[model samples]
Target: MKIVISDYKSSLNFDINYAISYLRDTLGTNTEIIVYEYNGNNKEFIDILNDADALITGYLEIDKEIIQSLNHLKIISIMATGFNFIDIQQASRSHIGVAVNQEYCTQEVSEHVMSLLLALNRKLKHYTNDVDAKGIFDYGTTNNLIRLDGSTLGIFGLGKIGRSVAKKAQSFGIKVIAYDPFISEEVANECNVELLPIDDVLSESDNISINMLLTNENVGFFNMEKFKKMSKRPYIINVSRGALINEDDLVDALDKELIKGAGLDVLVSESPNLDNHPLVNRDNVIITPHSAFYSETSILECQRIACDNVINYVNGNYDKMFRLINPEILK
Candidate 1:
């Protein structure tokens, strides 16, 4: 078996010896897999991908052209849960099996969301930066930071990680309400979360946390209209996919003081494009480099499960773990 791993970099900046070792072991005993440093719009990647038996990718986009060119391709393994980049319909037509790393980093993502929620609520990011600059920053001077206990936490989606976040919030004496239509009322109630409409969640929340994967229906879903509907000064946090919220509109809302503040773990990043982006200068707006799941525990789980999913399928048993996209291919 031969596989091509794209969007992988071996820069002095990133340490990825563990991932390389995992791939080598998974495709052990003369099975060949080529790993290439990512340089977008390269002919080398196109050439390598054409002859691949399977492919693993990080952040690069794979369109219908790439899918159609992969005559030997059997699988498209995404390191992340969202298959937004893959042309799923095209992969299906090409008989390419799609498996994503779904269960890994579940706790890390939840923890990061919790961190952002607490950080924003307590004005930790603002004052921490201030203290670092001035040598002393007061608690009362930054803003009126509030306590989390007895406050309302509105969860956008109540999947695995969402439930974990809700449970953590509940432990802090925060009331949880969610807006996941797929989850049964009984199941949500068991988790001690009130199932409510999107609007109601926006209206009543002290903090609005987004934990949903982006679907075609929800692309640019949180727009100006939704921002306008928010009442009672809710802090917004998104540790999920980036496209779920419009960056431009969010800056506009913040500029107009429509929302209280935003704590982002992931955003659409094209460095120079977003360098002078409106949210950069604001102390209230916090952004991370799509790194909600960068802890040691999370990284190890991602390496283990991603390699296992590909290895298991290659050995003839599909993982029932958490297949997100192209389930029929496994059949």
Candidate 2:
């Protein structure tokens, strides 16, 4: 069987040889591995993928049209936890299995969430900018600062990363509450987190953290109306998908002081033009280039898990697959 590793040589920042060697060792000498470095030319890569039996990719959008063209493709393994870029419904219709490495970056992402939350709460960017630009070193610049020990942190999703964040927040004496319908009350009790309705959480939180998975129903959900419901004018921190919040609405919220501040790790467009971007060059807003899931250890583990998923699928070891998005294809 032929397996294609696309856009990995330079884009993913990991050695392709490690993945190639892992696949070869498991599939024996009969396996054919192709390392294709995608150069933003989808048409060319689609033509090459037509003959691939399996594929491993990072953040490539495999739409219905592209999924239909891959005649021999049986499985796709994503190196990241978010599989919204892939057309899972179309792949399932085509009898193709889709899987993701969900366990690789839980700690890194949760830690990053804490970093952003603390930075926004303490006005680190605002203070540093004031000192650097104007040589002003006054501690009385902002009087709204409050200690996190007694503040409430409302989490939008109580998944693995969310639970980890809750644990870390509790260490700082912060009260934790969450709004995830899928998570059981028993699980929330075990984490020492209060399970509350979405509206209640929105109205009562001193700060908000978004850790939900992106879906069609929740895209652009955190707009002006939602921001208005924030009675406390809480600080917002998002380490999740950017499309979950409307950028225009976010800017309006900041301008109107509906929110204290925002720390975003992802944006609607990965390669946004910064010259005229509203979120850029703002003291109340902090944006990172979507690097919350990066660490040397996590990078290696992500590649290993991606390769293992493909190897397990080839060997009919479906039980060992990590977070298979489409399991009906196996039946």
Candidate 3:
């Protein structure tokens, strides 16, 4: 069997030496393994992937046309939870199994969300600029600083990372409310989170954390209309997908002071043009370069689990696949 690992070196800065050794040890030394680093030339790497039985990737975009062309591919294992980068439906039609490492960076992401929330709430950027940039340090420079102990934190999606955020927020004495159509009231209550509609969560929360998964229907859903509903002028915290919010609407909301501030870990475009990017270097916006899911431990865990998915599928141990996105392909 032959396997190709792509996009790991540049996209994720991950070393797949462990994966190569593990696959060779388990599948036998004769198993052919290829390392293909994507260099923005599809034709070059497409030739490499054409001969592979399995493909492991971090951020390579495999669209419909490419999926249809790779006739030898049996599985594509992703190193992250979000699979929006890949054409899963097309892969399914092509009888290609897709797997993801769902829980690898849960702790890192939740903690990053809290860090952003706390920094925004306390005007960390404003005060830091005041002192560092202008050489002035005064407590009265900024006002309306609220205590997190008595404030309400509204979560948009109550998935694994969202639940972890709720748990962490509670320890800070923050009230947790959530808007997740998929989660039941009983489940919310069990987590000590008050379940509410999206609008209600917006209006009532002193801070709002977006944890929703990106999908075709919800792209840019959190626009000016949603911002206007935030009666409390809540600080927006998003460690989730960037395309969920319209960047233009978010900038307008900030300009109008409709929302207090925003802490974004992701943006609509990962490689946004910084020369004219509206969100970059704003006093009210703290943008991290989508690094919320990074940690030494999590990276290794992600690599191992992703490789395990590929290995198990190649070994015909289908049940051991980490988390299959297109399980029907197996049938």
Residues 102-200 of candidate 3 have per-residue lDDT tens digits of: 789999999999999999988999999999999988989889989999899999999999999999999999999999999999889999999998889
lDDT order of candidates, best first?
Answer: 2, 3, 1
lDDT of 1 by residue, 1-331 (tens): 7866666342112445666678777677576767777777656677887777777776677888878877888888787777887899999888887889878887888888888888788887778877887777577667667788989999998999899999989999999999998899998989999999989998899899999888889988889999988886788899887789998889888888888899987776522256567777577878877778777776777766766767766777775434637768655
Two-way lDDT contest, 1 vs 2, winner = 2
Best by lDDT: 2
List candidate 2 stretches off by more than 4 Å: 8-11, 29-31
Name the weakest run of 10 consecutive residues (lDDT summed) in model 2: 7-16
Computed on alpha carbons, the lDDT of every model, listed in order, comes to: 0.79, 0.90, 0.89
Give me candidate 2's TM-score against the actual structure.
0.95
As a TM-score, model 3 comes out at: 0.95
lDDT of 1 at 140: 66
- Rank candidates, TM-score, best first: 3, 2, 1
User: What lDDT does candidate 1 reach at residue 137?
Assistant: 55
